[model samples]
Target: MAMLTIKDLNVYYGVIQAIKGISFEVNEGEVIALIGANGAGKTTILHTITGLITPKAGSIDFEGNDLVKIPAHKIVSLGMAHVPEGRRIFAELTVLENLKMGAYTRSDKKEMENTLEMIYKRFPRLKERKNQIAGTLSGGEQQMLAMGRALMSHPRIILMDEPSMGLSPLFVSEIFDIIREISESGTTVLLVEQNAKKALSIADRAYVLETGNIVLSGDAKELMNDDSVKKAYLGE
Candidate 1:
């Protein structure tokens, strides 16, 4: 069964239709990339799936439950974690405190601590700066912290939006590597990225979105080698 599924989703911002009817699925342990240019409605798809925005029509099912009918906070408790765009960490909180906040839905202290240790193991920089204020960290460090915080929820599926935005090339590589690691460790990933090259490189499958619609989708490697994708997205 697919880990998450969306069927004929439609969303709007008042009178402006931000996402036309679109559908996709993320299977268990797969890294599915939704690659699109700015304003292509990739993020809107994610927001609707995570309940930040209600879809005008369609069904978003995660593990047999309709996400559209559920509340946002309840979605996370259902083992779905969203690492939103811009690394929305609490600026004033310490790194460790921010991580703790990610696990607020849980009450098992021992399990939360174990999850924290796992996060530290994955991003050692977060462990080093555990006591430092979140806003004071460098861009790469902050991104890692954001990812680490998301993993603290022990989610079965992780939704990441523009994780490589505003980072050096080295950090972009690092973040993508970590994304692969996250998937290999049994978490299904639904990634929305502007960097088509990097996104396609690691994705099991990819969808191309243009102006609020999915224009194409196929094996990531096949999309990478396509003439149109090379011309428009890869700068080939």
Candidate 2:
């Protein structure tokens, strides 16, 4: 069933429309990707869904709740986690401290510890440097910390923006592997990435955006094989 649904989404910055009547759905346990070049408004869709940006017109439904009416902080408590484009962990905070902040919606100490343990098992480097300052970590490690922090929310669905950006090839590969593992373990993902190839590889379905509109969408593998998708996004 659809865990998240966006219908006729129209968003704008002042008078400039950033997303124009786009619609999509993410089913439970599915990894859905939105791929486009920079300025394509892919991130805008995520921001709108996560309640960081209110739409000029649209309806965002998360498990029957109207996301547009909900506050951003309350959205996190509703089992939605966003790992933003910049890995926006608190720079001065310790790694553990940043992670603890993600669980602010929760009150159960024992459950929190269990979640922390799961996060550490998934990102062992984080466990190794739990007390280290977040800003001191390498780019890839910072990315890991950001993801770990999101997982600490125990979300049913995750919205990831530019997850593989600014990483070495090896680290990118590692990050993608973990993303697939996360999906396999049953957390639905809505990924926005300029790296179309990587995004489509792990996604069950994909939407192609261009200049504030969804130009195409379908099963991930079919889009990967499409001539236009190959030429425009796959660099073939």
Best by TM-score: 2
Q: Give lDDT tens digits, candidate 1, residues 1-236.
A: 88798999999999999988999889998999999899999889988999999999999999999999999889988999999999999999999999998898988999999999999998999999999999999999999988998898899999999999999999999999999999999999999999999999999999999988999999999999999999999999
TM-score result, candidate 2? 0.99
lDDT tens readout by residue for model 2, 151-196: 9999999999999999999999999999999999889999999999
Report residue 23 deviation for candidate 2 (angstroms): 0.7
- Name the lDDT of candidate 1: 0.93
Number of colliding residue pairs in model 2:
0
Worst 10 residues of 2 by lDDT: 1-10
Model 1 pairs whose backbones collide = none
Q: Give candidate 1 misplaced runs (Cα > 4 Å).
A: none
- Whole-model Cα lDDT per candidate? 0.93, 0.94
